[model samples]
Target: MESKRSKYILIGLSVFCILLIGITSFKDGFLNPLRSGVGYVLSPIQSGVNRVGTSLYNGISNYSTLRSAMAEKQALQERIDALVEENSRLQSEQFELQRLRELYDLDQDYMQYQKIGARVIAKDSGDWFQVFRINKGSADGVQVDANVMAGGGLVGIVTDVGAHYATVRSIIDDVSRVSGMAQQSGDTCIVSGDLTLFGEGRLRLSNIAENGDLKDGDRIVTSNISSKFLPGILIGYAADITTDQSRLTKSGYLIPAAQFDSLQEVLVITTLKEEEAPQESTENTEGAQTGA
Candidate 1:
């Protein structure tokens, strides 16, 4: 009996809805109360659907705005990084220029000698001051036996040359030997590089005459008798002189004037020393002596 009653109520509601629509189409104001009641029943569902749509639209808009802002920030950060790198590069270039200028001034001071400038390209693979390569070589008129000098004094001599580079064996190398003299007392000595004396940055000066007044702080210069090096080039100062076991001659340490470890640029003298020629006897003199 309850089921039958529910079916009847549903059927009555359908009829009521159709009648309400017909009345509304006829423009009848008398059914306003019924329309008001039905509108009130549906209002809450419409409001809920509108709220959900607004919430979804707002979420999408916020996500788009955040993505755009992040992209802009990343682009700006990349640009800032590029600018910083460029600044560092420029600073390094400026420092290099200053160093080259100092080298140029040094070359100008030795204008009396025919000189060529070269940049240090490489250092010896094994030791610090054993050997180094210069950017200039045969193509730049650099040849074997060219004297190399640094800030303080004579550094070494060129031993090998290539098309674009030259190798110099510094005076500190074990293979190097130079004829040196005490500038003050004219004492002659042989300066040789020894591995044992490398820690003191000095070379062994031997063969000083026993009677020679060799003293500490005496300046040592390259002697004219040296075949490879030019005459009168400053080499170093004397230190720790003492008699050898044989007591036949004095020996000491020569502190090198040139700072081999800090060498960056150098000048290679191109002019060779003029050689003196032997005088020839006249043929008339020989004939006169024979006739006499």
Candidate 2:
């Protein structure tokens, strides 16, 4: 039955084509209007299909361009971030180099003493360096009572020593008392720590002579009479010296030479105050035996 239906359809299409030919032959112009009518009806439909195809092609092209642009922008941003980080690292290293150079000069000034460099690993609570830990210890010739310094002058004394680390008690600590002598007139004074007023970065200077020639900005150095500190180490300048009401002694504030808050690296002088005395005694004993 399907084959018979197909055969009838084919015959019908053949007859319709013959009819069209015959009509066209009849007047030579009968088929012209029909052709024109078909063309007029299909023009808008053809245009619509072309427009749809063009829109699809343009959309795909624009999407690809947008993706490429976005990828390029992401790559550039990552490169910029990497460069910024590298620049920051370089700047930090430059600053550290400058500080180490300053410390090198300070070390040269004390050529008589054996020294080692140590980085500060920890600090005590507060704005001041009341106590801090360094990377060097007894194994590095850093014994308890060893003198520590940085920047321009004396910083602290080693209070504890371990195999690989040491602890320092800065002169700005509450329990610190550094005997200071005036570099100008040899007048002696005491530099006592008082954190109650440490916010000013000044320690209490006292025990000055009533007629002391100490004036404002007189350089104070560690006194020879100091029990623990080596003499001649610069402390800081005297400021605001005022005699007590009794007039027997005077007291004032002293700004420390070391920047206590931002201490990063320090130098430890291995010589101890008590060690010098014993060595001197041994020398004296040998000299006496030789004399005998």
Best model per TM-score: 2
Q: Per-residue error at 199 for model 2, in Å? A: 0.9
- Model 2 error, position 87 (Å): 1.0
lDDT of 2 at 194: 69
Tens digits of per-residue lDDT, candidate 2, 65-152, equal 9999999999999999999999999999998998899789998998878889999998877776778899999889998878899989
RMSD of each: 13.7, 11.3
In order, what lDDT does every prediction score?
A: 0.76, 0.84
Give the Å shift of residue 215 in candidate 2. 1.3
Query: Who wins the lDDT comparison?
Result: 2
* lDDT for position 150 in model 2: 94
**Candidate 1's C-alpha lDDT?**
0.76
